[model samples]
Structure formats: C-alpha cells, structure tokens
Target: MLEILFEDDYYVAVNKPNGLLVHRTRIAEEKKEFALQILRDQLGYHLFTVHRLDRGTSGVLLFAKSSKVATLTVKAFEERQMEKLYYAIVRGYTPPEGTIDNPVKPDKDHKHKAPQDAITHYKQLGTVELAIPVGRYQTARYSLVQVVPETGRMHQIRKHFAHLRHYIVGDKRHGDWRHNKMFFDELQSPFLLLHAAMLGFEHPVTKQYMEVHAPVPQNMARLCTQFGWKDVLPAAVFPPASEAL
Candidate 1:
C-alpha cells in the first residue's frame, strides 16, 4: 500500500520508499509497477505527478487528482515555491552550515556540476565513529545532516555536495565507490541514506499553505540509535515561509 503522508480532495502526498521508481523510464522498463501506478491503484482514482524524488530517495512525493491541478502544482515547483528538506549520512564531519553556490552543467560526455545560482542549506545533525579494520585505519568518521535544496536541478543536491567532498553515503554513481562498498559490506548498509524528509508548498486549489513531513526510515533510525543519536532532528520539519517566486 502507498504510505500516504497527506491527502485531500485537491491532491495527495505520500512517502516514497527506496528502490521505487516514480514512473516508467526507458532504463527501468523491466520493473513491474511504479510509484504512480501503485498510488493510483491504492487510491482508486486517477492521479498526476506534481514532482519527482529520485528512485533511491524516500519521502514526500505529491500527486494531483486532476490534470488542471497537476499543471498548477508543477508550476509551483518550477517557480521554486516548494521547499524540500532532506536527510543524509555524509562521508565525514562537514562544516557547521553554509550555502554552496556553484554552476552546474553536464560535462563533455557525462557528469554534471552544481549550477552557479544553486544554493543548498545544511546543518549538522550529529557524528559517529565506527571501528572497522580497513586499510591502515581501524575506524572511520561519519556525519549526519539535514539538507535543504533551494533550487531543483538535475541531481542538484547530489552533485553539489559531491563537489564539496561530502559525498552522500551509498551514492554509487555520484559518490566514492570504494567508500560505498566499504559501508555496504562492512556496515551492512542496505541502500543510500539520503531521504526526502519534508515538503512545503501552497495548496493550488485551496490557495492555502501546505507543509508535510516523513519520518526517517527504520534502517536510518536504527543506525542513529547505534550511534547514540536519539532523534537529533527538529520536531518541526518545515516552518511556514513566504512563497518564493
């Protein structure tokens, strides 16, 4: 069943689980059902996607019941009126908080950069030191953080942070492979730690403010407990703000 976060006559929002595709793409045709199809089936109604979270990303994803509503919701996203908060376990202890403004574009063939106007606000959640016999060291350091991507671009958050050398854990393509394998095998990590934690925007039909939050996954919760972090995140996920245009 689709894990609905919030729902109303105008639209529906839900928590997208990891490894679930938002829709059918050429690369993942072999997959049976997608989040869209599953949501529609579970809701027993037609629904249109407002925005997308990556396949590996888990959290607040919205869909509209009507095409007209879908158009309006998508416009809100394009206008940057929606605020998204994400959580991830990063490679190491990152800076306290800062904005990353850098130009992003595809390289000659592959790989992209974080755009110049791109801004990502991040705050450290906590840190942990894990002991594992690897290389010349028997331990490694990691940091947890809450990230807010001010701009929505192709792989914006992933690319931007990767360039900062704070690669998101388990980001195979845009991440450090050696480290990924190390964590997955030694630490027994199932998938990436990056999660879509919150989403806020105006209700297109109601013309009212809307904010939604999804709790961290069980695996992440367990990891945090192992590190002695008991809900370091703020109780209030997305506070109301003026709609950005």
Candidate 2:
C-alpha cells in the first residue's frame, strides 16, 4: 500500500515508492500496478493527478479528490505557484550552490524544434568519499544535493545533472553506467537516488499556504548512514517545520 502523507476534503498526497508508475502509460505496458489505481482503490474514490514523478523517483505526489480541485491544482503547478524539493545522491562533489539554466527539447524527435526553458537550483548538503575506485579516480566521491526545479520539463533534473557531469546515482537512462553499476554492486542499491522530499502550495479553496514532506526512502537512508551522513542530510533536505513556506 502507498503511504499517505497528507489528505483533506479536496486533495491527498502520498509518499510514492520508487519503481511505481503514477498511471498507465504506453511506455511501460507490461506493468500491472500503478499509484493512481492503487490510491483510488485504497481510498475508494476516484482521484485526479495534479502532477507526476518518474517511476524511479519516490516522494510527495499529490492528487485531487475532485475534478474542480484537480483543475485548480494543475493551474497552480503550471503558473509556478508551487514549490517542490528533491534530494539526490549525485556523482562527484557539486558546487555549494548553483543554478542550471538550459532549454530542453521535449524529445529526440523534436531536436530541431525550439526548446523550452528549463532552470534548476541546487545546494550541496554533504559529501562522501568511498574506498571503491571508479573510472580513473583512486576513490569514489558523491554529494547529497537539494534541488529545486524552477521550470518543469520532461526529466529536467536528470538531464541538467547529466549536462553538468554530476549524474545522479542509479539514473539508468541519462547516467553513467559505471557509477550505476558501482552503486548496485557495492551498495546493493539499484534504485534511483533522486527523491521528491517536499511539496508546498496554497490550498485552492482556502488559499492557505501549506507544505507536505515525505521521508527519504529506506535504501537511500541506509546509504546515508553508511556514508556517516544520517544526521546532516535530513537537516538539509527536510528543514525545520518552523521555516515559513
């Protein structure tokens, strides 16, 4: 069952697990389970998706309980009224903080078409070095980063990180195969390390600001523990509740 993070009369959010599709899609036809169907069945009511997370990503996923709420919530997302936070274990050490401003095409087929603007801001929370060597490096290095994408595009965070050459660990499509394999073999974790840790937006009906947080997945948390980062990582990713939205 999906973990319910927050729910109310008009909306519901879940701590989506990695490897679960948000809904049925032509890309992965063989998959039998989906978050949409599971949540609907579990709640005994139809829910409309306000946004989406990649199948490999786990974190706060919101759903509207009714069509009206869905429309309003979607508008909020499109207008950039919502703030989303993601945590990632990335290759190498990222800058203490930076922004990626690059335009992206929807797909390879649209390579010649005009690209849409994509921007992402990130902060390095912690770093770790492992004895395991990768590529030409004598030891492996990784950083935990808090990422906020200002403009949403298909795989924006993954693509931007790859562009910067700091690929997210376990990102198969746009990541370093060697690094991915290292995590799989050494850490016994093949799942993507990117997670949607928090979501903040205004209530459509009440117009009250609210924020919802989802705990890091066990696998990622374990990796943090192994890296001696269990304490600092969460403090950076999940800030104190007193921090205003």
Q: Estimate every model's Cα lDDT from 0 to 1.
A: 0.80, 0.90
lDDT of 1 by residue, 121-156 (tens): 888888987886545567777888889998887677
TM-score of 1: 0.89
Model 1, total clashes: 8
Model 2, 140-220: lDDT tens per residue? 999999899998888899999999999999999999999999999988999999999989998989889999989888788
Error of 2 at 158 (Å): 0.5
> Which pairs of residues collide in candidate 1?
102-115, 102-116, 103-114, 103-115, 103-116, 104-113, 104-114, 104-115
TM-score of each: 0.89, 0.93
Worst 10 residues of 1 by lDDT: 236-245
